[model samples]
Target: MLFENQRVTPSVSGAGEFMKAALEGAEAIVLAQSSMEELVKVHKICRRRPGMKLLLHLDSMKGLSKTPEAVSFLAGYIKPDALITSSPQAAVEARRHGITSVLRCFAFDEESIDSSLKLIERANPDYVQVVPGVIPVTIRLMRAKTGLPVLAGGLVRTDADVCRAEKAGATGITSSCPDLWQAAYVSRAKRS
Candidate 1:
């Protein structure tokens, strides 16, 4: 897995201590709920910190349109490693522009799971991020159905949760919890 070593990609709400902690041993970071007004600052931050992949959450990026042109603008100007969104249109556009696309799906029930799978098929995203990632069964089901790598996120507060998500076949875990961010990189031998 591309993200196996850096298992816990931190979802940042802003540029602060949490962001700094998240960058420690992490290969990627998700700019969670970033607004359009902050694009310049965010780009600068990611630029200064090379080697760490930056992912922008499109759904939460206020003023950003869900169009192919928008995706092109982001790719050409923002320069993020990837883009995450619940919109299938955005996912397609991201792929069209050669930026890695991640489909963010919420699986609360069987109906939602079915819908999410359909969306995944249509978008053909490079990866899928499942919210409320504690459900190991759902994680397995999603992986089997979509055949896309899963990045388990939401409510992942402990190291045990991280291990559980990985054991269930998640390529990696995403969390805003600083402590878990550090713990996710601990050597298995040391953890044991």
Candidate 2:
């Protein structure tokens, strides 16, 4: 699914970040580094925002198993719009459960890029998220190789970083910085 013209999706890990992202009019937010206890609360907050897409980062979440059973729970219980994971099995399971699966890859070197490509072939996820988004060359290569929409994440700290990723053909960007969220919103607004 498209991000509905929102280039920057807030990558939030806490209630405060969630609230700030929601308030800043983020169309989507990636929930990472959160606990099971926080899921319901964060889900409630996301529910309040009409048409907001919530993507759970399964790899970093606390108390959540990276299994198909856990994916079932997420699909049936939390009902997020998407699932972000590094596990090929988990990514496939998420799609099997009718959730949009995002395969997270760390492309620090040529070897890692090859490995990521292999993982992508295995998972066949709906989207690919490449880490350390500052690397425009990697982003370009990923898009060329996979042909799946790429969401740039990790170290995407500034508006300049966002622009670079966009120029590199990233479909969207994930940033934890609230300021960048607002900046993205404003930039999109101005373009409109």
Best by lDDT: 2
Report, for every candidate in turn, its global Cα lDDT versus the true structure. 0.78, 0.86
lDDT of 2 by residue, 70-171 (tens): 999999989989999999999999999989999999999999999999999999999999998889999999999999999899999877888898899998
For model 2 the local lDDT of residue 112 reads 100
Winner by TM-score: 2
Error of 1 at 15 (Å): 2.2
Reference-based TM-score of each model = 0.88, 0.94
Clashing pairs in 1: none
Q: Put down candidate 1 lDDT per residue, 8-82, tens digits, no spaces.
A: 777776666335754466557777766765666767776777765777887777788767778889988887788
